[model samples]
Target: MRRGRIDYRMQRRAVLAEVRSGVRSVGDACDAHPDLVRAATHVGAPAREPCPLCGEDDLRLVTYVFDRKAPANRGGRAVPRESLARQHERYGDLTVYTVEVCTACHWHHLVESFQLVTRDTAVG
Candidate 1:
């Protein structure tokens, strides 16, 4: 696919459908079927969209995050209530992304902005 041709809305619908089916948790489903993740997080813009840094209209869609990612519950210790805010501060959310390389300058760029569904929000 050219990246520009993917439909994000439709892809999300499919994922949501699976969630409503009670077949598997969203996390499990996403792990098993990464395509859903890809579709939900894929970024697309005009063929000649300008790069944010270089302002060149040749930038391509790279990668993205679909939902939010939770912080790693380290060491099996119960997290202190005071640390909850820190956890959120440390890991804002789950994200998916891709890299775009400049053909002319060989400059590589990563686009990471897709938010992932938090563990709290998603099923276990």
Candidate 2:
């Protein structure tokens, strides 16, 4: 299959709809790995909405930031949404991904992603 930008909002809605329709169980959907669980628990921000997977209120939003100039092995960093402006200033060309996770069931999904740099700036 061809790879391209993803419409995360649509994808999230579809998954949630499936859950709501009883087509899929939240427990089954939440199959997060140990490291992902750890990151979401420690670095993620608490979300206002409940977990779509398990209907738990312990959902968190974990953000990962990436830049072209950053080292391959050490580029992605979990950061807070409030710090995006500062990160954008520091990393001229950056892509940010916000993922929602359920601490209760290890359920995770990408909430959103976007380029954080100004349009005039050159990205490589």
Candidate 3:
């Protein structure tokens, strides 16, 4: 099994830099698809900090999990953190994504991504 993780902080920082430097507009960055807008609006854990784009107190942290069997699994549905612990046992290969979103401004960023697999199944 492939065991690896990816962090998207650098990518997010690059995008933020573009926005701050006037190379990209926050509106452009926040102009997400309708489905994403709806999901970000209703799903995920509420964040305490205000939105970096619009200064709204409506940010949230969203998590999405995918397995080899279902790569395109569930369309941006909000999965509770507790559920992930259960998934680790069921799937041998899993990719987890954590995303931060500002519901009020429609701003969304991929916070991080990591792999999860059971010790019994992970290959050396």
| Number of the top-ranking candidate, with TM-score as the measure | 3
Two-way lDDT contest, 1 vs 2, winner: 2
How much is the lDDT of residue 41 in candidate 3?
A: 63
lDDT of 3 by residue, 36-96 (tens): 6566666677776887788888888777778756746454335765577777677656778
Q: For model 3, give the 10-residue run with minimal summed lDDT.
A: 68-77
| TM, every model | 0.26, 0.76, 0.78
* Of candidates 2 and 1, the better by TM-score: 2
Give the TM-score comparing model 2 with the true structure, all chains together.
0.76
Q: Please give, for residues 30-52, the per-residue lDDT of candidate 1 as tens digits.
A: 23133322322343333345433
TM-score of 1: 0.26
Worst 10 residues of 1 by lDDT: 74-83
Error of model 3, residue 93, in angstroms: 2.9
Query: Over the full model, what C-alpha lDDT does candidate 1 score relative to the true structure?
Result: 0.38
Ranking by lDDT: 2, 3, 1
Model 2 Cα lDDT, one tens digit per residue, 29-113: 7887777778888888899888766678989998888985788887588887778888888886677888888889888889887
Worst 10 residues of 2 by lDDT: 1-10
Candidate 3 Cα errors over 4 Å, as ranges = 1-3, 71-77, 90-92, 120-124
